[model samples]
Target chain A: MDYVLTTNALCKNYRHFKALNGFSMHVPKGAIYGFVGKNGAGKTTLIRLICGLQEPTAGDYTLYGINNTDKKIKDSRRRIGAVVETPSIYLNMTAEENLKEQYRILGLPSFADIPELLKLVGLEDTGRKKAKNFSLGMRQRLGIAIALCGDPDFLVLDEPINGLDPQGIIEVRELILKLNRQKQITVLISSHILDELSRLATHYGFIDKGRLVKEISARDLENACRKCIRLEVSDMKVFTRVMDSLRLEYHVLSDTQADIFTKETITRLVLSLAKEGCEVLSLTERDESLESYYVSLIGGTEHE
Target chain B: MNKLLSANFTRLKKDVFLKLCIIFMFAIGALLPVLDYHVMITYEFPRYIDESFFSYTSFMVILFSAFCSLFIGTEYSDGTIRNKLIVGHKRMDIYLSNLTACIIAGVIMCIAYLIPYLLTGIPLLGFFIVDNISTIWIFLGCNLVLLIALAAIFTLVSMLNQNKALSAVICILGLFVLLMLGAMIEDGLNQPEYFEDYAYMDPETKELVIEPSTANPYYIRGTQRQIYEFLSDFLPGSQIIRLSAMDAPSPEILAMYSGIIAVATTSLGIFFFGKEDIK
Candidate 1:
């Protein structure tokens, strides 16, 4: 697995409060890695540390295989674009002007791509209007546009759709998906909006109390949270044999309990189990959402 | 670093506050000379071009204080400083680029004042009346260095403090405080050593009596006076006041002091700014 960003025992402390305590995670080369945690769970702190906005108190991180302490890490950093906490854009400048300014900062040879970049974020028509006049959504999009000016392979956004309306959230979500799928840009987006994040992330890292509790691929998480029929059979040996014979996927939980992951008819299955002398004691349907999985992973109150 | 500097200069060119400051400086430069010319013609009094030539120093101090504050403050207020860092520009480069842009702006403002000052003053009041041409050159050189030092000090204040409004208030108020302190020190240094003795008819009794000379109470002498002299030459505020009056006893030393202040403040600002945790 090629990782674009990797942190090892990364720690950040503000006076007495430890923002990131031995935190560690790996963002693969082409994944929309959703960083999930409650408010003040070191999401922004980690973003700041990786963005070079703040230095870690202990441990280190690597960008594109370059260690944080390496001077060449700056060269590595040029490959990344990030909007930390808020969209870092000049409010007095128009969207086009903001992108031009970023191009100048990046020492680009020309402004030829300014229009295309603006259009990429859906801000191409904001001609002459300063960013101060832009709506919250427009400004967020402009921030993304500015971040894209460098044509970076890695993009980091901190709460990108934090204060947007539903329409705005949809626009940003579609943009992220487009950036990841079409451009193949690796995105590390930190947001507390689990439902929105679940829509875009190919992978997830659940953070709690400054430590990453789990990092799982979206496919694996989906499987873990998949809908299935819970069953308590009279005999696990007979149930496994019947399930295998019927070509049904099942996970054995105990000597008498299992979860059948198929849509086969229950009456026929019961009759077959009866024929095999394996009686069904209990049956119920179970479906777990990403939000519930997050809750269970972090062991916090619901809706946190 | 070059890229950051290019970006800063591009921003500086479009800065409305800076354009206003430049216009105000040119207006002051062009008007003060005309006013002095009006007085010379109306009152039949002699006025030298040097009188108002260095006057731009005082205005530069105030304008640069305000300009550097708001300019750098806008970065923090708008959060654009993060763009530079996120793009992998070194903190040292960011600080230096800002300082360079500000110093150039300060120089441009000075030139904006000088163009009119020279155009009007040379034709009306004539060239410098000082004994040595080098004195004029020294003052001019030291004044330019003084502007650089002023930019450095204001940049330090603005860069270290993230809040734009607060840094502007501090820079403006800080200038006034330094000026007041400089004026007080200059006043102490200007006191005469002693009062002359004289004989006069007493108002109460019609008798003439001779009195001996007594030491001037306000006189600052010895080491205290030396410290005061060094300060008048060292501090940017005092240097501005002295240069405006064309009373710099050691222009080279003043320029050196300005150089030291410029280097010191910039070093301190960059060091602290590097350690600052940007949000």
Candidate 2:
């Protein structure tokens, strides 16, 4: 019932371009909200607006029950830390120094927590190596460490795993989970990489062209994206005839295609189709992923 | 153990621009007197000596005013500002911190910037060398503060724009306009019409004469009398802070009160700048 973030008809325009067009979303407290969208779908724009980098042209948003326009919004913002698009770290500074600079900027009393925060991000051993010399994963962790300087309860990360190698990706992924699990930090992560998002998200909101198509919990999404057997046949009428005769649970997709939800062996189904005088063209199995589910919601042809 | 890292050596902990400005200030500061000597020995040009500051405060002020905007503007242009703001900081804090850094960097400029120039005047200037060293020092100190104040004000302005080059252009143009406006206002106030003299003085006698007539008995010269009167109530530093880079105060020992006023005024600007949002 407690929502950490809520937006109502939030809109933003850059010249004639609509960066956020009536975007509305709710992030429940303590939930890892995965903001699923393609590139240029207003994820970063919305993050920027929420972070106060830019103001919304119309509508309202609330953080921790405090409205964006309230005087206490500053105090509310203190609870949220974001890495917008890329980690903003001073490449010339060491990870420790970067954390200290951030702490000073946030007006925290002292640097007592610097080492521990760096340790939390797994950048503790990076003693005097400047951030510029850091590996991509190290830089990202340092950036996250900088975000953690104020002890924020909510973390907003934009493409946090972008451009990382496999090992680096795994490191960052683990770090996010650790922070969220141990510290109880609610995370709002925006990423185009849905497979990875599916690995970490507790909840999801799919956006296309600045409008949220669906907002669903992971458990519900799993049920909606259930696995099924896809079939390509010589004739759909015959395919449906055999399926209807068998009383199987299925869907007729096209003249040449159909999908069955029932667990039937391929050889048995092949013989069954043959008896109905329908030849099997091709058969494939599909365990629906977030990407396909998104495609199902807002259909689009393959991009890559 | 954290204290093992020396705070002085903790210079590593500051912004690159702030560090570069300080380093540039001292380097220039150390080289100034020697450069002045080079100019004097080779070119036989007269050198001006001001001891109130480290050395070359004017040159430092000019450099700070021209370059500080670029440093602030670069962050906005590269979208680095978004990284800072997203970390739970209000936009106002971003502006204020950068502004404070700029002005404090200005003070550093005051110390190291003038000492070298002051040393160049080692022996003394000849008769032709207009020797108002004390007043010039006072003026330089205040002028440097004013320059930093201007830099602080421009930091907020520069961040208003997204393009670094355009922001730099607008800031320079804006500073020039303010400087000109301050000058024009002061000049207009100083230039009084004699014929339109105040009530206490007789109009016929005190009126500035445009023509040789019995009606207009007095002819105004330039702006000295009015300037002299304004000079009594106002410090040369206050006038300099106003913008047009007013004429230096009458020859006298530069006092701490004027320096305090200059620091106070410049500090106010930095304070306002610190609290403004970047975008």
Fraction of native A-B contacts kept, per candidate: 0.88, 0.31
Per-prediction TM-score of chain B?
0.95, 0.52
Model 1 CA lDDT for position A13: 98
Cα lDDT for residue A188, candidate 2: 97
DockQ of 2: 0.21
Question: Among all windows of ten consecutive residues in candidate 1 chain A, which has the lowest summed lDDT?
Answer: A295-304
| Candidate 1: stretches off by over 4 Å | A245-247, A253-257, A263-271, A279-284, A302-304, B198-212
Superpose all Cα atoms of candidate 2 onto the true structure and report the RMSD in Å to 1 decimal.
9.6
Query: By summed lDDT, which 10 consecutive residues of candidate 2 chain B come out lowest?
Result: B1-10
CAPRI quality level assigned to candidate 1 from its DockQ score: high
- What is candidate 1's lDDT per residue for B1-279, written digit by digit as tens? 999998999899889999999999999988888899999999999999988888888767888899999999999999999999988999999999999999999989989999998898889888988888888888889988888888889999988898999999999999999999989988889888988898999988889988989999999988998999889889877888899888877788989999999999999999999999987
For model 2 chain A, give the 10-residue run with minimal summed lDDT.
Answer: A295-304
- Give the alpha carbon lDDT tens digit for every residue of B1-279 in model 2: 122122212333355655676678767766655666668788998664432233343345455665657666656653556655664454555555566555656666566555543454454432223355454455555555455445555665665656788877776676556545545545554553554433354487995545432333333345854564454324432344342233445422223434454456545644654443344
TM per model? Answer: 0.96, 0.69
